[model samples]
Target: MQRPAYLHASYRYGFWWLALVALGLLALGLGLRDPWPADEPRFALNSLEMLKTGHFWLPHRGGELYPDKPPIFMWATAASIAITGSVRLGFLLPSLIAALGTLALVTDLTNRLYGRRIALLSGIALLSTVQFALQAKTAQIDMLVTLWITLGAYGLMRHALLGPARGWWYLGCAAMGLGIITKGVGFLPLLMLPAWALLAWRGKATPLRLKELGLGLALILGVAALWVVPMALITTFGDEPGMAAYRDNILFKQTGKRLATAWHHVKPWHYYIVSVLPWAWLPLVLGLPWVVPSWWHRLRRLDARVLLPLSGTLLVVVFFSLSPGKRGVYMLPTSPLLVLAMAPLLPGLLCKRGLHWLATGLLALLGAIFLVAGVLGAAGLPALTELAAKYDVTPWVWWMLLGVAAAGLLVWLRPRRGMLGLAAWLAVFWALWSTFGYQQLDQTRSPRDMMQRVVQITGPSAWLAQPDFDEEFLLQAQQPSVHFGFHTDQDAQFLRAFDWLTQAPGERWMLIPQRKEDQIACADLSQVNDLGLQNNEHWWLIPGTAFASCQGDASAAPLFVAPTTVADAATAGYQPATQQDQDGVTATPEDSGK
Candidate 1:
């Protein structure tokens, strides 16, 4: 079974080209845009708050403890921001670095197990997959956690299949501990142990002693304690109001309860297998027809290399699937191992004409769709124009789309090299989207424009309060603003906001979501200024005068939590709304245009 000369050449030099393409695609959009929700802004803000308040152990969002997950990712983001001095640059660095790290580990491990050609193909497969590329470009915890898990798997695999390499096993355990701190699911690599145990039972692999397992467990706990123990102590004994709740919620609720009785993002057990794999694992999914058969053959011969990663991947899928809650990203930890399992077969499968044509057809279809959409958008097609209007982006975005489409089509012309062409098309698509697309959509995706307008209407001297505010809104606020609470009910938030508004009528304003406008019984709606739509929600600005028509309840005192810099608050002469200003105006006309 002699590999072709061209294949060997590719194996020798393919890694560098893969690295270059990855760097260009993933890092191209760094610092060009603000973090877009539903997760990016929240994490970015967490990091920013960490840097601002010097509270790295307990993450906060809008001045309140954010216990939904541990602070490892935030710590990484904060460190990046501290070094780079730019949130936009710092926020995405961890994910980008993690992605590269994952790639290197997958490639190197695959090389050791299957040789260089399979390794190169493995890296290419990972980079070209929709899930991997999407998560790499996203500033989410999933990708960073994925890196840690992959490192753990790499070390464990090295020890299990390659040797009784104690050092590598310990490294894997430590990495998994780090992963746990990054996200709760970091211990996922431990699932690989079952396959290893199966091999041991069959007299095919080295058995880990009870002492070795205990020590590995110790290492994992020891690594996680680097953050957890300190956090637990602080939150337990600290004078902070919500520290106890934060500790319990994070330690128990977010981990075990979140997994078992999961409240949100619920889906059927087959969600990942059906909805996710079809598209998210693209190009890789296309190769499964060949990979499954090869894997089965290898398994029948009791090949430990094939058994370890394949079993681990399936175990992870089943682990997440059994849970009532699911998200496409939750299945991310399985990708690296899955790709490794498929790597050995990719060399043979890729040479098949059917696979080549499939690759070519996919690229062509994608290219044609984008090219036609771009042309129509540029010509002011109603549907495209409406979409642009909805996002509040200029038609220039379509021109950029046209350029990307043209570039992709150019690559697709080489039908013989369809897989390579497909990879090339993806690189072009990511690079353009990261740069031009990021800039074009930043204004609409972010709350910068809306917050700037809020500051303008309220004046520099006026303090602002936002009730039921989102993370992006608070992140972008120029004024020294206060939020009621992130999880507070809308009615309670409005009541407290009304009470706060009456305290300093002329010097303070309230920003409320338009959807919740009906909840403000104390405020005069006619005097509520419209702040227009931002982040797909209309916002209304309420002057102090808007609340003068009703009497405030003494019980509804404001719970002002300020997330903005204290120095900025001081510079703006912003005081807590509890400090009433006697000499304040009672009425002012609503000026929506302002």
Candidate 2:
């Protein structure tokens, strides 16, 4: 009972091109829509400042030195700001463009190497990958970084396998360099495919001409230097040594020492292995036996092209496995490499009637998961929505996701339609992110808004101290001039001694705010204030003597007394400080300012 041989070759290729285009659009939409965590907005704001000030060096966030990472992500956003006149969208565009571009590249390259049906399945798999799609819209540089890395690896592999082509070499050089600029260091992992291609084949190394190699290398270095040299010059002279420290620690430490620098970047070795399940899902587990069987057969026969992609994927996975610090994104570039490696065989796995049931089952599981995403969105986001009322559109996005998941379940249940089921599910999942989730980003206040709130609370004369960093993060919202901690709030020298006292000589107003568990910094504000309220993560405002008069009783007796920097003249103009104001906390200025 042999099935017709035509089934393998007869996959409808014409619509897959359209599918790729749809995926690209979906990716772009996803990227543009989700602002996600504060980190992404912070990147966007920094880049916006770079564009506005025309100064690429100093990232004056919240009106101070913003020292962290090379400004590659910022530089990227500057281009978007120029075109769109909106920093928000500009910040997200790189990831969106990178994601969609990667899809097109995968479809085009894999189709050329494998077949139309393979191209379709690979494109759907990579693009629809639940986590991957979500990450594309995030503000982080990882998505674009992965795109360049994938391209670089693919290009280098092509040159190695097909003999040295001038274009392939040049593209390899350029893509690798862009990959470096995106995240700094670790570019070698991205080149794993090409390296594996060379290593898997036992013959003499295919040599590139010194002239061409040098030329390509120069182009790569030139593009990288465009961003790096400026950062070096500025950090050498900036008030903050943070950027300089990062440069020395990350670029110089190369791999190990810097892993200890930040918690967000820190994790156990098995972190990636634990995370691979969500990214690869059930299909990877099901396809494992088939993958190795083919691999063992091909390797015994010494097939360079077949070995190249597999080796590349393995190299990256094994390399990241050894890193002390492993975030989910560390293996991002590996996604395309692995997808491309398995592309030729994966479709056959999907096409099989018995084996294909696993794919359907996986789709059903995803449907159940997304159905939960819908419920959580409707249930969980209201608290965030109540606090962040501007995100009115966010709740609908969740419901829409649920609806799409329901639709996907219908598509997935049909007979022999795994490919189409993948597309429908991805569409609904991403569609929720693009139109509904993206709208929530606008609810946040920029540095400008934050500064205004601080000003409205404290008078012009009060010193606005930052107990943590330079307070650059808050300033990136594009607010007017708010003095640095030294000028507006308590200077560093007085922050420790009797900070919560009603009045301290040079201290104008205490703005020390408390923080959450996952905050980047830690401070014991016990000496500063018993202020019952908190901010971003830590540090409470120290109440000065003057606040008591301001907080007496709001209804004519006096609203509430507020702590002040100087006991002499009380600041005026706003309603008296009270324990129960619009923000819903029951801490009057007197309660925590001590």
Top lDDT prediction, candidate number: 1
**Alpha-carbon TM-score of each model against the true structure:** 0.91, 0.70
Q: Model 2, stretches more than 4 Å misplaced?
A: 1-34, 57-60, 63-67, 115-117, 189-223, 229-250, 253-256, 259-265, 280-286, 369-404, 439-466, 469-512, 515-594
Top candidate on TM-score is 1
Find the number of clashing residue pairs for candidate 2. Answer: 43
| Residue 57 error, candidate 1, Å | 1.4
| Deviating ranges (above 4 Å) for candidate 1 | 1-13, 394-413, 551-558, 565-594
Candidate 1 vs. true structure, TM-score: 0.91
Residue pairs with backbone overlap in model 1: none
Q: List the lowest-lDDT window of 10 residues for candidate 2.
A: 566-575
Which window of ten consecutive residues has the lowest lDDT sum in model 1? 585-594
431 Cα displacement, candidate 1 (Å)? 0.9
Candidate 2 overall lDDT versus native: 0.54
lDDT of 2 by residue, 411-468 (tens): 6456365544655656665665565554444334223234444555555455553433
Q: Candidate 1, overall lDDT?
A: 0.79
Error of 1 at 13 (Å): 4.3
